[model samples]
Target: DFFWFNPSRLPSPAEWVNVRRIRVKDAVDPLWWMSKSAYPKANNRRVLEKYSDSMIQLIQNGYKAKLRPSGWDISTKFQKDNGGAIPPNLLQIANTESNSWYLRECARSGVRPHPARYPSRIPKFFIEFLTDPGDVVLDPFAGSNVTGEAAEATQRHWIAVELRVDYLIGSKFRFIRPHPVLAVPAG
Candidate 1:
């Protein structure tokens, strides 16, 4: 995949007539879908069918079709609050360590290294939704660089930024090439 923030490009779903948007943001969270909504998993179904059919076609036609969404808009405001939601007490945790550590370790060893992959489909959907082939997609806090991988998989250019050196160095997957990072501009 091409990893670039400013120079490269991503893809737009307009390329495929099959992909369409039927509704706007859900009422509960303008940015997310309400689980109780009738079409809560609308995009998911379409994505699955598209990928499944494409996989089958690739096996028979000797060519693979890359499917991406029409737009790429990631918002962090709508996430559910985890402050008081977590269980009051668990088997682990000392007064010195933050609660996040337990969850982090659980995530690391449970299934995938990054238990929270943020769903590859989400980035793939965004890359497809907001851009066109070769268009550049920039992700400033690209945790795990999933966006970069999704962009590359969709043939779009991707650029990612992450301040945590350990996440970058210890990542199990390499979706974006590492460049010498410079300091952020001072205000």
Candidate 2:
């Protein structure tokens, strides 16, 4: 049943076989004041310096979640001003109030960047595609354990690993049943 072979290892329809992504709600932190409270508007630089690590981690991890940049209209612009080739995928569209900026601010201010969340759909898709009814799935970097929730919904066993203890505990709310948690070895 294999129709295509992608030697480049790019994720393609044929290579995936049954694997796919799922849909879920955006997990951005609901509380907004924390950003300002921790890093006052006046002392933006100070805040940025303090929580720089969190910001870097967020930027690095954002790509894995496939959070396409929001707020640009390339099609509209191409009609009026033609300068550079329009990127086919449009990884990031220009938006004034960008998520990247917000995340960077949050990371710099030591405020958790409203937890850039993944939708349940993402994990659901993967579970349905890659696994059968009883097969197992693993989310090694399970932030809020949304993957576990999706797996549960689709009747697939899941193993979600998170370094932070609080997230591991909070993930229980999202899942109907709890899957066994395994400790990841420290590098």
| lDDT to native, each model | 0.46, 0.47
lDDT of 2: 0.47
Task: Report the number of the highest-TM-score candidate.
Answer: 1
lDDT (10s digit) by residue, model 2, range 36-113:
244433322211212245444444454233333785433322232222232221111111223443345445545443
Off by over 4 Å in 2: 1-114, 176-187
Q: Mark the regions of model 1 whose C-alpha exceeds 4 Å error after superposition.
A: 1-115, 176-187
- On a 0 to 1 TM-score scale, where does candidate 1 land against the true structure? 0.35
Report how far residue 51 has shifted in candidate 1, in Å: 14
Please estimate how well model 1 matches the true structure, expressed as its whole-model Cα lDDT.
0.46
